[model samples]
Target: MFPLLEVLKSLAQLSLAQLSLAQLFTATVIIVLSPILTDRIAAVRSILFSNYQDYFFPQLTMIIEESDGFSQNQLYAAARTYVGVLFSVSRKPRHFKCRRAIKGEKLVFDFVGEDFYQKKDIAREDSIIANFEGIKLEWKSRAKINEHNGETVSKYFELSFDKRHEKKVLEYYIPHLLARAEEIRKEERVPRLYSRGGSGLGEWLSINFEHPTTFEKLAMDPTLKRMLKDDLDRFVKRKDWYKKVGRAWKRGYLIYGPPGTGKSTLIAAMANFLKFDIYDVDISSINSDLDLRKILLSTSNGSIMVMEDIDCARLEKGGQQNKASSAKFTLSGLLNVIDGLWSNCGDERIIVFTTNHKDKLDPALFRRGRMDVHVHMSYCTIDGFKLLATNYLKIEDDHQLYRQIEVLLANVEVTPAEIAEELLNSSGSSDDVVLARLVEFFEQKLHVKAKAAELKERLKSADIDVDAEGLVKFLKQKKLENAKEKEVEQLLNSGDTDIDAEGFVKFIKQKKIEDAKAAEAK
Candidate 1:
């Protein structure tokens, strides 16, 4: 009975100790919760998202159901994205919205610096003002869609501020702020449109065509180098002019030549020369005439678009397109894309079209406005060979190979690509051997192509009609007259040449010569 009582007493003591521990735990938990209760937890809520069903990202999301136009959530997201926090006012908007974003930082950016602003902050307190302005962000929104204040309009940013928040959100939170700002702008804004001009030409070219690397080599041509220098100068000065021109203030070049010519390489050179991205568009991949517009509309600016072998795009490329026959795009559709109504989607672009058969293109499509510069990347001419030797071989006028090259260059219509290859082949060898081997290789190719060209010319002339011969004569005369027009323009524009100055000089010279002739006859 005594042992039983002792056991009960020990049991009671153990139970009391357990109760005391439980009470202490409860008190400690309540104390930890006291501070949290005084200050509310962050009001951040997890929101649902589907990229395809979201407004900002169309490519990342895999969409399903009601893909006809867009899902309801997508439309709402798009509308908010377009009406992106209005910018006219100096203060933040009352409502701040970022719930749907898993990567919310991507959507907003702080625009910093003096250049972006139209008005220079020329106040005496410029430093102070700039400091304040730096804190302010210029949010970039895309204009691919229309969403104005409570209405569908092209996208823009709102500038209202939150008066309630005491903390200036930019300073404490953002480090490497400028770079982050750029990222968000890239993500949220409807990217600028680059020209489909050159990219549109890619659909026409074949990857397996002879001399694929020729395109990269040909851009180094001296005339192209000079042009590129001038082009950069113009781009520097006229960057804003690109925006001002109702058109995207871009340049286009149409490179046309026979097969194995360096037309395509010139495009690559232009891209590399400018350090710009390439937008390769295949008209066949586009489903509808409208779809071409969408693709053109979607590309970012500061890019070059290449269309290779444009002649064959219509005739040879029924096989390349993956979509069904009903979705096959048309020639008219492509032509519209080059100089279409909605083509004015972006600014400062370059379009390049390469063709082995310039004659195959429609005269209307190659008109002046559609193509600014029509470059003939013909078989090597004397001028071209001199440039190749000077550029690729680094041969000076006094060099031994220079004379030999002149002789080979005179008789041959060798492509620059062919010259470049031969130069590279023996680049590590003795320069003399490299030159000799190159001349030999080129002489052989020259004979082969020349014979083929001669055969073709014979065939063509055999089929030429009498009327066509007259047309050729007329075209040649017109071509000569057109060549003279530029000279006349330069002479006239230089503030020289009185209207009758040349005529008066010629009249006096003719009178003197006639008198001299008369005296001789006497």
Candidate 2:
């Protein structure tokens, strides 16, 4: 005690001017480390008094890489979403970074390296300590340069929690995180349409799908539209029902119609309504059954696989013989891939096939479970015409031409495509002029029908054996002529008669003669 008192007295006698440089530096170090020494003393006291089990409990850790077996690059996205949600609400971090992005003519802000929660020695980097149902968990993010490829970098997240909470984390907490991430992704990103690349390989090419057609905008019978929508709704809700029935959780639709009918339009509408990506499979481009399997396997769940003009794929029973000479895939191979065990691997998938001739398709393709729903897109009905009128001309049901258009629609087989084209052609004209033009077009279809009947009667009287194919060809030719005549009549009726009417008439006569000769040769 006497020696300590003498040392303190000697230190007090020294002033700032009398102190040496080394002594001043040591004093400054002591002053800077005083708080740290105090904290260390408090930590030692806590360790001495606290429960040993609580201080040394085992913590389970999980590391999630940017790429997973199921998704190539989803973990990073999930972590970003998780971190974004935390920073958005808490904003407890000291350091933050910002990124600028343009979204639809608006500038958006994004943040990174923002901490939501932290603890001594336990939480570091972009980490957050969260308590879910009283189970404390810590999430940390890390970035590292790839050892194999120095130029590339990879990222991951580490989740640490008490071992007692492992079950909850595996069963509920992780699933909750994934669901939240998906919700965020859906809100921020536009749906995409994926198609096979042109290289005849199985690679997919993605493009932003911007088709705006919905059920309300499609020109079809209201009853049919409602039925289709109901079918889709029921299918979406039948996931458990499908499992109970021991069937693949998928649906198939067959849309058969003429070229001008709205089969493709309905497909687009269905895609938009369901918010599903479209995988348009070009059957002709596929090289082999192996290639087909690869393509099908590469497609993700919740997508529509479309095969347009399926009848053109030559899917008849014995057509494999003809196909084998040049093609690499067989009819049976396609059928197996479509309905066999491989098809069951995907969930919430839809297969759609469109054709101009349903009768030409094989019976095997129409089996009970293969094509669950068959939609026939026929000629434009009055309801469809009215819908088109409202869409194209904003003419409601109370319009003066509604009655005339209804009456004409009942007798003619004009397609929605033709009607839409007519409406577009007359867009610059007055409402009355447009309606009048549609009336003239309908009248020309009536004229063509009358002429067709008259020709059939003449051919029957002449005892000509007209095959079904020949009759179909003849009718198609007349339909083409009807379209051309409608255009010519529109020009003449629009006060453009001064433009070579005689020469146009002669040209029409010459075309008819050539068509008749061609039909006879066929």
Candidate 3:
């Protein structure tokens, strides 16, 4: 046992000496390569590996920039969507920021970067690995600086994949990504209306369009409203039918009405119903034919272009020599723009023209296929009045004034705008007060009509040669005076007394005779 112990002690001492020599050799090597040589060795290794990779495993790269010319680049938007989708499904990324969406109920988390090489599987600025259908790709975000500008950070995304997978990436993967991105945008982004700012190409100013009007809120004839809704629905679903029929995928509408009617409101309803953007073009703002063309061509697909007060634009028959004294647009130029070759560029387009004076418009503007539909906005009927009553006062059917209001609306030529204004004013007040005010308005309208008729008969008996325009003006003056009389009578009645009937009749007769003489002299 003693001999065995001596042999074990000798072996332990030899091992201790060898371990000390190895430690000393390692210390010397570390001191030699501590600062600069360590960095040099790493640089040499990286250069060698990079050169080897370039020779053996070549890569294909695609760049998606943030802006193209004056417009936001589509691929950049797609890349954002792509990243968002990855973040939704990925459990690997640890450093992320949550983004509360502006329009939706869900929150989105976006990945951020620090030391890229710390985690091999996590997303970083230099590389983000993604797998699709057994194929792998790397996404990298980079910023390039401009020498002339002071640290201008122009960002872009670079997609790199093996050269062997280039065909699949270009053919199927990229298109799929674009389509998915578009779907996301449509579901999340609020729509905007765009218009040309000046003479530049693709220069657009955007406005958030959030019109609340819809077909159900529009106060019109029920049958006519249903027809319009059906027409619009059919137009939207008939893309293939339009192609088969060899017609442009477009429609035109001409809305004619008196002022204060629901022409503009109906346009809003249509826009909201279709989820389409509205391009409201002021005809007076257009300077020349070229300017008009530029505006028309800049409009995107699936949009409505509206021109209000078409008759006021003074569109005459002759091309450029017509007496369109107030407007710079010529008749031929307008017509060609509406139906010419340039209009064929876009799909799913709608053109709307609104005019208060349909009679004043040129006949050529309303030819066979130019305006596919003609809608007339007339005075509010009993149905329309009920709609307004329900909408404004929340009085569905229990009101005592509905019957009387219905009778008055049938005879009076008041517009929906006017009724809506009155109803809005009467809101939150007692129902009785609203009914009485509406009744008084109707009574005044009836009195004006009756007095105008009486004046016309008297003028005919007197053999006056007054034209229609002159007679209308004279009648308006009489109506104003009658309104004053009604106000005076109301004041008297409020005091528990009435005006002297005989005295009032005498005063009215004297005033009418004086106005008749004045009008005759004129």
TM-score top scorer: 3
Off by over 4 Å in 3: 1-164, 185-189, 198-202, 321-326, 456-522
Error of 3 at 285 (Å): 2.3
> After superposing candidate 2, which stretches have Cα over 4 Å from the reference?
1-173, 185-189, 318-321, 324-327, 466-522
- Cα lDDT computed for each candidate against the true fold: 0.51, 0.73, 0.74
Query: Lowest summed lDDT over 10 consecutive residues: which window, candidate 3?
Result: 495-504
For candidate 3, list the clashing residue pairs, or say none.
none
- Model 2's C-alpha root-mean-square deviation from the true structure amounts to 10.3
- The backbone clash count of each candidate, in order, is 30, 0, 0
Tens-digit lDDT string for candidate 1 (265-311): 66655655554556666644555667665665554455577766766
Per-residue lDDT, model 3, residue 38, is 63
Better model by TM-score: candidate 1 vs candidate 3: 3
Q: Each candidate's TM vs. the true structure?
A: 0.48, 0.63, 0.66
Best by lDDT: 3
What tens-digit string does per-residue lDDT give for candidate 3 at 400-518?
Answer: 77788788887778999988988888887887899789889887887766665665566566555557586455445554566677765664565322234344345557777999999
lDDT of 2 by residue, 1-522 (tens): 123445446668998689899987766665567668778888887787655645677778898876544233455556667766665555343445554332333233233321222213234444566667888877776655445544224457778999888999999988888788778656665456778665656346677677878899899989989999999988878999999999998889999999999998999999887777788887778777777677676666667888888877775464363543334566777777678777787778899999999997788988867888999999999888888888988877577877888898889888999999999999978888998999999998897677656655655565554664775665455445655777656754653322232443445457778999999999
